[model samples]
Target chain A: MKARIKVTLKPGVLDPQGKAIQNALGALGFDGVNDVRQGKYIEVDVAGMSEEQARTEVERMCRDLLANTVIENYTYELAP
Target chain B: MKARIKVTLKPGVLDPQGKAIQNALGALGFDGVNDVRQGKYIEVDVAGMSEEQARTEVERMCRDLLANTVIENYTYELAP
Candidate 1:
């Protein structure tokens, strides 16, 4: 099975990377792009697991490996 | 309008950060995890646009701001 994890900075956090990207967009002539928040994408592959197991295991992966508990949040979905 | 963007390292690129996470997962006893590829997640909010236009505009935002095209690729879906 294949799973995708989305890890992001928590709300109320100041994302300097995101702010830098926002400035870059303005410089590139993209109009009305009000804001940008940057995070992380992690994809993992597993074998011999049911979809439910994949979700649970992958969630564990997020909490344990991919995301920082202090300042990040994560959500994941299985690739169908 | 709301959109979620996923940016990932292109295949064939060595992802050191991902490898580090994989090692961490192994240390944490996540069994049968074969690989990890790390990337980016970005969320943006928009107003006064149709879904079609949002897609286009957001794509521009991605190429212009959120993603580095040299070694990264990106995909996004609208939040309905």
Candidate 2:
């Protein structure tokens, strides 16, 4: 089993890093790069578990340490 | 159109940030947290563009700023 976790800043949040990337993209000649937001991804191997167990484990991971709820939110894809 | 980009450090790579999180989770009573990896997430509005165009745009963004290919890899989900 494997899982892919995505963590992102919620909407309406300020993303200075993203803004910097947006500007850099425009300077690099990649036109129509209308917007850019920065985020993180985590991939893990869930060797033993059902979908329910995996989800519960992942949710705990997110809330406890994987994410800073004050500034980030997360979602994950788990494949058995 | 909109997209979600997830960035993560490749496996076999040390993740100090993740280790820190894992420790925190354990301290907080989140048992069974075998591991934790930290990453970033970005969600953006793609107002207009086909999937191909958006992908090209995103790849450039990842290369230029969103991700440091030397140590990170990224994947994205786009919904039109």
Kindly report the docking quality category of candidate 2.
Answer: acceptable
Error of 2 at B31 (Å): 2.2
Write down the C-alpha DockQ for each prediction.
0.71, 0.46
Tens-place lDDT per residue, model 2, A1-80, is 66678777887899898887767767877666566777766765554577898788778877876778898878888876
Best by DockQ: 1
Compare the candidates by TM-score and give the number of the best one: 1
Residue B64 lDDT, candidate 1, scale 0-100: 74
Candidate 1 per-residue lDDT over residues B1-80, each given as its tens digit: 77888888889999998888888888988887888888888877666788998999988887876778998898898875
Please give the RMSD of candidate 1 to the true structure: 2.0
Question: Which lDDT tens digits does candidate 2 get at residues B1-80?
Answer: 67777778888889998787667767877555566677777766665678998887777777777778999888888887
Query: Quick one: best lDDT, which candidate?
Result: 1
Candidate 2: which stretches are off by over 4 Å? A1-3, A43-54, A68-72
